[model samples]
Target: MPVRRFVPIAAVVLVASLAACNPSATKSESDSKPAASASAGTDRDEAGSSAAPGAPAGGNGLSLSEAIAKIPAADEVRDGYKRDSFKHWIDEDGDSCSTRNEVLLAEAGRAPEQGARCALTGGEWRSYYDEVTVTAAGKLDIDHMVPLAEAWDSGASKWDADRRMRYANDLGAERSLVAVTAKTNRSKADKDPSEWMPPAQSAKCTYLADWTATKLRWKLSADERERAALETLAEGCSGTAVKYEAAP
Candidate 1:
């Protein structure tokens, strides 16, 4: 009986020893490695996300005045500027919605119903340029915040066709393209702040901010008169801030 009992005791000790040495023998030990790795991965992900708010790291928190000061002052050249130099209103995603339609769709006060081929109907829009309210889409024009010609005069004349195309159809910034009445847009055609401003008195400050933001975004230069005009206009827009993302 003593011999049998001793053999059983030794077998139990051996089994326990094997379990301690074998990774697969204990379920908790096997799961602990993956669990620790997952926890480390989670910590890394949180760290990466914490740094995202300041990312894109282009231009985030600049006062309107400070932003305007960054644009280099130069003489504007209208030479060789043509409307066709920049191709626009493209269906960039083949969604059948042209850049023009896309702007209209986004700025509509009442969302329009989209149909086959991106046909839009039954929407209301408030044209901030003139403060006009309209229900018809045809009456609206998608105005480039910085007109193509103005862009050309500033510095885009030197850019390649592809870059010019991107400028013309810039949807990356909400302020880059605006929906406004056709009349107001035509009235402001190819004119900088020095020559034109929104007819609505309330919209002037916002307009200046938009113009400044767009110029800064594209690294566009401002002429002497244009800069002066911007300064004068900015005076009325106290406590205003400009935010923009640099164009790629």
Candidate 2:
């Protein structure tokens, strides 16, 4: 893997607030899914310091094992899933850049030239899933680390439209949405670590950590096989630690 340069990007304000957006929502609706120890999300660095100006950051010191252990395990609900159920790629911030463009700009190894309407001309990106180097933004796909279909299966099926939309376009945590080659993104589709792992040998541990962090961040559930797979894979990732902020 090449040494990549990550440029800082602004934190997008997706909605006014999760509570304000959903007036009728109850505390249980917001808190019911999280495990006791992994109930919240915060963005803390390795040194366990503060987050950026507007970004929500905090401490989730759980090792990969503990993080995986806190994920609620339940049977998946796969029926009645529609790709459109979760709206994505919108410019919620009205910054001319959509959620996809924000990810592209943030993840680009070489920053792309931004034009009117956020047209990206040239940039370089490393598709971590396959470790493929891509210079064209058009060739990269913004992947939901936790696929929408997978989220729906886990626990999103019961969420209202607004909450589902937040999950789909989440920009709160860097791990939630990733930029990768379209090929690798398509290959991953909606399969979890249990069914698919990254082709890049070096990406496996980071991939597992990110996957676990994303699930815990949103308080999403896991099925038995998926939970077991995460636990089994986590043993090899002893050096990796997960830190995520609870999505508001």
Candidate 3:
């Protein structure tokens, strides 16, 4: 068998590895490549999109003001924040389903059934990781920006499953939301922003921005190495980008 390698990491590969083992991760060569690739890409992306939020006018991406402005302040909540507290993806219409699948359908641009369950009926995904385009639902995976188990390690080990569900199904934010090829998602599984990112070189700034934003929201603190990695990511927020959010 040919040894699979990743230029960057992404959703599919990470997801599988997250579930296949655990976040402490004994990830395979197939598993590690894309997540690392994507994670690195988000750190890089000098050649970016004009409309991508991270970059500035004729430049790379956003400034610290944008990154700070967009992030919900850690002190805003009086209540404790834990991973298990957010109840997510319950069958909204009383069908046998969950919200996580609904996001998969929407992210994939698929029109789901009345229940909005994950049937993966129709959608087209051009995976930035390996540059593969897929139409089948099975080919795509809905990824959580913060992996559940990783959350457990971070602070979520204490919350109830319902709360965990909410974190799992949170689709309200662009940073926390995305759809990617199944292989990439599986490979990502449950890892920190420090551990993985997207595979598209063009998407680097946005990836880091999302990472920073997600970390801020969860009130999760990064170790020194993680913080240093994020500082490097901050460099991407240069061209064509502006302040990211309205006061939160």
Q: What is candidate 1's lDDT per residue for 98-205, written digit by digit as tens? A: 888877776666778989988898888877777688788988888998999999999999999999998898765555777788999999999999999988875666
Query: Regarding TM-score, does 1 or 3 come out ahead?
Result: 1
lDDT of 3: 0.45
Please tell me which predicted candidate would have the highest TM-score against the true structure.
2
TM-score of each: 0.76, 0.78, 0.56
**Candidate 2 Cα outliers beyond 4 Å, as residue runs:** 1-60
Query: Lowest lDDT 10-mer window, candidate 3?
Result: 1-10
- Root-mean-square deviation (CA) per prediction: 23.2, 12.0, 13.1
Error of 1 at 244 (Å): 0.7
Report the number of the highest-lDDT candidate. 2
lDDT of each: 0.65, 0.67, 0.45
Residues 1-248, model 2: lDDT tens digits: 01111322212111112232111123232112111111112221222233323322423245678778888889999999999999999887777888899778766767899999999999888777787888998998988989999999999999999999988877665667888889988999999999998887767776786788788778899999999999998777654545555666
lDDT for each residue of candidate 3 in 1-248, tens digit (9 for 90 to 100): 11111111121112221243112333334323222233211211122221223322332223443543444322112245544455555665454445555444434433434433345466555454445666665666666665665555555555566556645655434335455677777777765556776676655554565555555555554555556556666565442122221101
Clash totals in order = 0, 7, 69
Candidate 3: stretches off by over 4 Å: 1-89, 93-97, 109-118, 128-131, 158-160, 240-248
